[model samples]
Target: MVDADQTFVIVGGGLAGAKAAETLRAEGFSGRVILICDERDHPYERPPLSKGYLLGKEQRESVFVHEPAWYAQNDIELHLGQTVVAIDRAAKTVHYGDDGTHVRYDKLLLATGAEPRRLDIPGTDLAGVHHLRRLAHAERLKNVLTHLGRDNGHLVVAGAGWIGLEVAAAAREYGAEVTVVEPSPTPLHGVLGPELGQLFAELHREHGVRFHFGARLTEIVGQDGMVLAARTDDGEEHPCHDVLAAIGAAPRVALAESAGLELADRALGGGIVVDEHLRTSDPDIHAAGDVAAFPHELFGTRMRVEHWANALNGGPAAARSMLGRDVVYDRVPYFFSDQYDLGMEYSGWAPPGSYDQVVIRGDAGKREFIAFWVKEGRVLAGMNVNVWDVTDPIQRLIRTRAQVDTEALADPHVPLADLLP
Candidate 1:
């Protein structure tokens, strides 16, 4: 057990940071714990911000990770609306907030998370221009969608990534006219590849979502600081009262960067460089969640996963490591998404060029399929769309590293468990 005088400082208020504090307490670490959050709200999960919360289906209280009283009860020093301005690596202290409150620590965790990438083009400052990364943003969007629905106005989403597509679905459900502009030919081109990407396109099209493929938003034409329409590179203009920038997110690594922590290269998904144990170059510091680019033991490469599961699992793993436990945070990356009536869970990494073939088990046309990315006859990743109760078997296939027969893998009659070696 650690001495009570020792202190651990965590510089984030997301799932990862909150879970780390819980883990530290559960592990019997009788030490001071400090959690710094830039946002005023309690530590919260972000998935609902773009999903159920935006749809107005989930309660506002459901977003928070813990009750307001939980922090004080747990003896956690929670600092809300306080941003860590600088990290003094040599001094082992952090300067935060407007008044520059100082906090020293024996160990530090950078779970700074990520921020939504903003549109670099013009007219983004207008009213009705939205981005969904925080609960406050979700609240604003919920109201915007309601107004758009009532006014019979339009919402143009810029990007075909998960955020863009999910927000599109929510907007449509609210009775707002929706249009998506993407630079890629298909939605989620970088993630699901062309085959599965087209499936999403058809799914949205069936639900009245217009797609502007192979084009990107260049300008948001507005008047009196309110969005009017958006223009694409193809010179086609989409008239809309509101705009949502769902392009992507950049890791919040400024604190880590300023502290001279080594960062992963941009091509490898830039973030603070960490080992399998989540320790940074400084050894006394660690990073988790979206801001940690660590070596993936299974894939033999560095990866920075920005999913809810990563934050959920990574925080506890980092907390264990901080407690000097032999922890290897190699839980296969996992994440789930809900759009309209479709629910999908993806496991493992299978980016483009990493897999040679995508084998489908169920009917792709029906959208009840499990698609596997295979290379050298081994499963690289698996995604189940509208399928139930197969996450275990799917992840098992990825972990076994066993060569699989394509025919049997694609055969629904052949049990996924039977294919396991």
Candidate 2:
């Protein structure tokens, strides 16, 4: 157990960091807790930045993980807008930017999160081009959407991932013509499989959003530093006033790399490698959130998840592990997204190329369905689209790994709980 006098330092001021600080206090760690955040804003929920906050459905204050006063009240020191330049593991000190401020820590948690991957196509630096990762980025895009609402502007989206699709839905809601270009045959095919991904494609099509599947963005044509069009490798030009690239995200592993922490396999996308308990190569340090590539107890494989739920749960789990408490970060992975009128919640993990068959309940055409990914008669993962109050059952089904009858699973009349052992 950590001594009450030793200081604990947390890096990154995102949801994971804030949650870790909260966990430390709640776990009765009376030692000093310092949260270092690169962003000036207090820790906040990022999901709304793309959906609610950008669309003006939610206020900025509502996005914060904790009110600013809560940090002071909790006695957690905030080092906002300061970058930790390096970690001297031998000296047990975290060096800040060139000004030479350093903080000593008995235990350190890295929750640096991930950054949106940048597109390398020509004109990516244009004024009307943007990437959604932070609240500031969302604010800027919201302004662009507002302007597009006034002028009936066109938007060219370079990806059809979650961010891309959600932003497309928001742009269409704002009366902008949206064209999403994806090299994949269907949106979210990499994660949800072609069938379910195609459902999303059809949903967007119903909302009047155009799509260019099996297409690559060759260039972003611009004039006066403002995006004017997106040209595809297939020799097609899509006229537009704004462009959003939501290709994916890469974990912020530079700090851990510089500190010489072991990295996960390159095939796993190379994050800070950790054990099931979230302990890094250095026992005194731990990693959580998107930056942590740890062995998943459920999947029995090394994996790193970039969703909000993982960070929300993993933060506290890592804190407990840091406190030398016997802990295992074994919660089943879960995530949800909202696009247009469709809301979806997915539970369990089914990595790419895994899960042989998809069994569906309800009507896909009606946009209300629960789809399960089954492998060898065992449920690996399940997603409920526009279906309410079924997440717990779906998650239980996944957790149980029970052999399910495909016919019963496909029947809406068959209750989900009946399939559980």
Residue pairs clashing, model 1: none
- TM-score against truth, every candidate: 0.99, 0.98
lDDT of 1 by residue, 340-368 (tens): 99999999899889899999999999889
Best by lDDT: 1
lDDT (Cα, tens digit) per residue for candidate 2, span 190-227:
88989789899989999999999999899999898988
Model 2 stretches astray by more than 4 angstroms:
none
RMSD of 2: 1.1
TM-score of 2: 0.98
